[model samples]
Target chain A: MPTIIFNRPDNRSERVDASAGDSVMQVATTHGVDEIVAECGGNAMCATCHVYVDEGWIARLAPMSEEEDELLHGVAAERLPNSRLSCQIKITPELDGLVVRLPDRQI
Target chain B: MSASGFTPSAGVPHMDIDPFSIEFFEDPHPAHEVLREAGPVVWFDKWKVYGVARHAEVHAVLNDPLTFCSSRGVGLSDFAKEKAWRPQSIILEADPPEHARTRAVLSRVLSPTVMKQLRGSFVAAAESRVEALLAKGSFDAIADLAEAYPLSVFPDALGLKPEGRENLLPYASLVFNSFGPPNQLRQDAIERSAPHQAYVAEQCQRENLAPGGFGDCIHARADAGDITAAEAPLLVRSLLSAGLDTTVNGIGAAVYCLARFPDQWARLRSDPTLARNAFEEAVRFESPVQTFFRTTTRDVEISGSRIGEGEKILMFLAAANRDPRRWDRPDEYDVTRKTSGHVGYGSGIHMCVGQLVARLEGEAVLSALAKRVSAIEITGPATRRFNNTLRGLESLPVSIKAA
Candidate 1:
C-alpha cells in the first residue's frame, strides 16, 4: 500500500494508505484523515480540498485545468506554484511516497 | 454608458433594482434580462449591493473570493457587528485558516465513500416515499415528495431526535431569509427560530448526538479543537439551512418541469439514466438558492463597473442561470439543454457542500418515480413559496398514473 503524509501547523500528522487509484483527497477522506475538506466531492468546483504538493511530487501529478485554476483563486490560504486542488491530482503507482500540506482554509 | 463616465471605484451597473418585490419575485426574468443586457455588473439598490447577472461574470465573481471576500459574512446583517442569535459557522463564514479546519473535519466524515455506503438506505427511503405517493395518484409534490424525502433522511442521518428535528425548516428558512433584507420575511423567520437557538446549540454537545452519524463527527472535531463545540450545531445548522429547503425546492422544480413538459417526463421514463440530467436541468431552469451575497475585498472592475473595497455584492444566480448571453432559448425548459455549468448549486469555495447528497436524493426519487409512475400531469396551479433566497413551490398538485 502506498503511503501519504499530511502536515498540519499544530504538528498533527496523519498517514493514509493510499488506494492504488485514489486521489490524495480520496485516500485522506476514506481513511478518516481530518485535514482535507473536498467539499465539492472532487468535482473541481470548490477549493475545499486544496493542498500544497511538495516540489518533487508536483512533477508527478497531472497539470491543473482551467476549472481547477479558477477554483484555486477562491481558496483562503496563500496560493503558491505548488498549490493544486487535491481532487484534480490522482494518486498513481508513481506517487508511492507523496507528502502534501493542508491549507489553513478551503474557503 | 460612456467609458470615461465608468469609474473603476463604482462598478455599479445601471440596473440596480429591488428583486424581492412582488412583481420581480413573482417573475424576475424580464428584469434579469435588462440587468444582463445593461451590463455584466449590476447594483441592487434596495440591498445596497453590487452584483453580476451575466453568466460569465457570476461565475467569475463566485470563483474569485479573494477579490470578493466572504469573511465578513454571507448574510445581509453583519454578524461581526451584531450579536448573532446563533453561533457562527466555521466552514460557512470563516476565511481560510479557520475555514480549512472545519471543512477538513466535515469532508472526512461526509466523504463520497460514506455517501456511497448510505446510498442503499437513501434509495430505499426514496423509493418507498415515491411508491406511497404514486399510489395516491394525486398529491402535492412539495409537501408529499420533495420536502418529505430530505426532511426524513437528512435529519435522521444527523441523529436529530423527533422534537429537535422540527426546527430544521424554520431554522433554515430564517438563516437564508436573514441573508436578504431585514424585513418581515427575515423578522418572522428569526422571531420564530429565536427561542430554539439554545436547544439547537445544546444538540451539538457530545451527549446529544448519537454515535455513527455526521453530527457526531462534528462533535468529534470540536473535541479535536478543529471547531469549537459551540460552532458544531451552527455548522450542523449550515447543513439544515442549506440542505432541506434547497433540495425540496430542487425536487419540486424537477417534478414541476416533468409535469409541464411531458416530453421530458416521457424521456425520463423510457431512459431512466436521464433522471439525473433531468434534475440538473430543472435546477438550471429554476435555481433553488437564487442569490447569495459576497463582499468586495479590493477595488475590482467587471463589465465596466468598478466596485470599491468592502462593498456588498449580491450575485443574482437565478438571473445568471437564465442569462441569454450564455444560453440560447434561456426561458424554455429543455432537459436536453446543455445545462452542465449552471449556478444552481452555486460556485467556487462557498458552493454547496451537500450537493452530492442533494443530487443523489433527487436521482433516487426520480428513478423511483420512473419505476412506478407511467405518467404524471399537473392538475392545479403550483403555488410558489415566498422565500427571499429559496426558489421553491409551496404546493404542486399532480396526478400520477402508476405503471
Candidate 2:
C-alpha cells in the first residue's frame, strides 16, 4: 500500500493508504474524501478531479496525455504548472509518499 | 448562410440521410455506419450540416470549444440568428468565462456532499420499486420499473409540485427533438409539448418551487450573487429539462442489458457492488443521448479536411461510442470493461452536469435488483421509443426470478 496525503480545500490534511494500481482519485472517492469530485469517474474527460502536486513529488509522476492536458485547460480554477488531473495519476510504489493539494472547487 | 458567417467548404462528401427520420430513429446503427465510413466530416445534404461520426474526431471537436463553440447553440438552430424555442441555458449554451460562473455555482449545488445526502432516500425508493416489480414477475420494464422509479423519487427531490410532474418527460422530449431539423417528429412534439413546457416554466418560478429543494438552493445562490436572480429559474429549468429522461433511459438500458445477457445478470447477482459498473457499461453499449450539434467558430482542419467557420457540425455521440477505432469490442455490453472514456456523457466543458445523479439512480435500482433478483429474462421483444436524440426502449417485457 502507498500512503498519499490529500490537502483538502478546507485546509484539512488527511493521509490515505492507497493500493498501488488505483488512481489517486479512486482512493479519494472510495475513502469518502470530500476534496476530489471525480465527476467523470476517472475518465480524463472532466477536470473535476484536479490536484496540485507538491514541488518535490512532481518529477516522479507520468507525463500528461493530450486528453488530460485539454481537460485541464477547462478547470474552473487557474491551472498552475503542478496542476494535474488526479484520475490520470496512478498510484505506483514510486509515488508512495505523494502529496497532492485539492483545488478549492472542481466544476 | 453559414451561421458562423463563413463560406461552406466545397466537395465535402454528401449524405442524404435524415438522422431524425423514424427509420433512422428506429435503427440508427446502419446510418451511423454510413456516417462513419463516408468521411471524417461529411455534409448532410438534407439538413445541409457537416456531420462527424468517428470517435477521435468527435472527441477533438468537443474538447476544442473555442474553435467549435456552444454559445451559438448546441442544436441545429443557432441561437445567434434564430429565436430560441425557449430561454437559452445559461450553463449549457454559454462559452467559458460566462459559462464558468454558472457552472461553478451549479457544480457546488450538485456536489458529492449533496448527492451523498440524496443517496438514502433514493436507495430506499429503488428497493421499494424493485420489490413491487419482482412481485409482478413479468412486467414492462420501462413503464413499471424505469419510468416509475424516477418519477417517484426525482421530482420530489427537485421539490416540484406533485400535480403536474408528468410534464417533465414531454418537456424533455420536446427539448431534445428541437435539436434536430423541424420534421414531423419535431412538429408533433412541439404541439403536444406546449402544456408541459408551460408547466415547467411555472414551476421554475421562485415561489412555486418547494423550500429546501435543489431549485430553492439555486435561487439562494442568486441571492448571494453567485448567479443573477433572473438566471435562477433558467438553471432550474435546465435541471428539469435534462435530469429525468436521461436517468430513465439509463435504467431502461440497464434492465435491457441484464435481460439480454443472463450471465452478466448472474455476475451482478453474485457481486451486487458491480451495480454502478453495470449501469455504466449499459450507457456505453446503449448511448441514450445519441447526438448533439456544435458550430465552428473559425476555419479548422480535422481528419485531413478543412471545415469552414459557422458550419453546423453534428457530432454523433452514440456512433462515436461504438466506433471500432476506439474500443476493443465497442458493441459488447461487458460490465467489467473500463468504460470511463466513453462519450455516453458528452465530454469537455459542456459534459452532462447531472451524470452523477444519473449514475446514483442507476446504481440504486441495479443494486436493489442484484440483491433481490436471481435472474432477468426477456419474455418478449423490446419495443423501441423513437426520439430525435435519445435512444431507449418504450417497453421491455422482462421476467425476473426472486433470489
Candidate 3:
C-alpha cells in the first residue's frame, strides 16, 4: 500500500493508504476526502481533480498521457509544472509517501 | 464529391443517412455500424457536416476541444452563423476561461457535499414512488417510475413552484432537438415548445426561484461577483436545460434494461449495491443522449482525414458508447461490467454537469426497487419516444413481483 498525503485548500492534511492499482482520485473519492472532486469520475475528461505534486514525487509518477495533458490545459486553477489531474496518477508502493496539494478550486 | 468538388479530405467517407429520422432513432445500431465502419470521421452529406462514431475518435475529439470548439455552438445551427432559438448556455456553449468560471461555480454548488445532503430526501422520495407503483402491480415504467421520481425530486430541489412544472420535459425536448439539423423534428418541437420555453425563462429570474435552492445558489454566485449578474439567469437556464430530461430517460433506460434482461435484474436484486452500476450500464446499453455537434475551429486531421475549418463534426455519443472497437460484447446489457469509461454522459469539458444528481436519483430508485422487487418483467412491447437527440422509451409496460 502507498500512503498519499492530500494537502487541502484550507491547509488541512489527510493521509490515505491506497492500494497500487487505485488512482489518487479514486482514493480521495472513496475515503470522502473533499480536496479532490473527481467530477469525471477519474476519466481524465474533466480537470476537476487538479493537484500539484510535490517536486520530489513528480519524476516518480507515471508520465501524463496526451489526453490528460490536454485536459490539464483547461484546468480552472493556474497550471503549474507539477499540475496534474490526480486521476492520471496511479498509486504505487515504491512511491509510498506521495504528496499532492489540492488547488483552491477545481472548476 | 460534393457539387463544389469538395471531396472529403482524402479517404474520409461520406454518409447520406438522416440520423434524426424516426427509423434511425428507433433502431440506430445498424446506422452506427455504417458510421463507425465508414471511417473514423465521415461526412454527413444530408447535413453537410462531418461525424465521428468510433470510440477513440469521439473520445479524442471531446478531449481536444480547442480543435473542435463548442463556443460557436454544440448544435447543427451554429450560434456564430445562425440566430439562436434561445439564450445559449453559459456553461455548455462556451469555451475555456468563460466556461471555466461558470463550470467552477456549478461544480462547487453541486459538489459531493451538496449531493450528500440531497441523498436522504432523494432516497425518501424514491422509496415513496416505488411503494406507490408496487401497489399497482402493473404499470407504465416511464410515467410511473422514471419520469415520476425525477420530476418530483429535482424540481423540488431547485425550489421551483409546483405550477407549470410539467413544462420541464417539453422544454428539455426542444432544447435537445435544437442540437440537430433544422428539420421537421426540430420545427415541430419548436412549435409545441413555445409556452414551456416561456415558462422556463420566467422561472430563471431571481425573484421566481426559492431561497436556498440550486437556482438561488446560482443567483447568489452572481451577487458575489464570481459571475456577472447578467450571466446568472442563463446559468439557471443551463441547469433547467441539462438536468431533467437526461435523467428521466436514464431511469427509463435502466428500467427498460432490467425488464428486458431479467438475469441482470436478478444480479442487481442479489447484490443491491450494484444499483449505480446497473443504472450506468443501462446508460451505456441504451444511451439516452444520442448525439451532439462540434464545429472544427480550423482544418484538422482526424484518423488521417482532414476536416475543413468551421465544418460541423457530429459526435455520435450513443454510437461511440456501443462501438465494438471499444467494448467487448458492447450490445449486451450487463450490470457487472466495469463501465467507468463509457460516453453515455458526453465526455470532456462539456460533459453533463448534473450527472451526479442523475446518478443519485438512479441509485435511489433502483436500490429501493431492488430491495423490494424480486423480478421485473415486460408486459408489452416498449414504445420509443422520438426525439432528435435523446433515445428513450415513451412507455415501458412492466409488472413487478414483490420481493
Candidate 2: misplaced stretches above 4 Å?
Answer: A1-85, A88-107, B1-11
Q: List fnat per candidate, in order.
A: 0.00, 0.06, 0.03
lDDT of 1 by residue, A17-77 (tens): 7877777777877666555765454666446688988888888887887557766665658
Predicted candidate 2 versus true structure: per-residue lDDT over B64-146, tens digit per residue: 88899898888888876798877788988899769878876666666555776898999999999999988898899999999
Inter-residue clash pairs, candidate 1 = A105-B96, A105-B100, B11-B305, B11-B306, B11-B307, B16-B43
Each prediction's TM-score against the native? 0.78, 0.83, 0.84
lDDT of model 3 at residue A25? 88
Report the C-alpha lDDT of model 3 over B313-391, residue by residue, as the tens digit.
8899888988989898998999887676678887778777787788889989999999998888898988998988899
Candidate 1 structure, TM-score to reference: 0.78
lDDT of 3 at B340: 61
lDDT of each: 0.75, 0.85, 0.85
Lowest-scoring 10 consecutive residues by lDDT in candidate 2 chain B?
B1-10
Give the chain B TM-score for each candidate.
0.92, 0.96, 0.97
Q: What value does the TM-score of chain B take for model 1?
A: 0.92
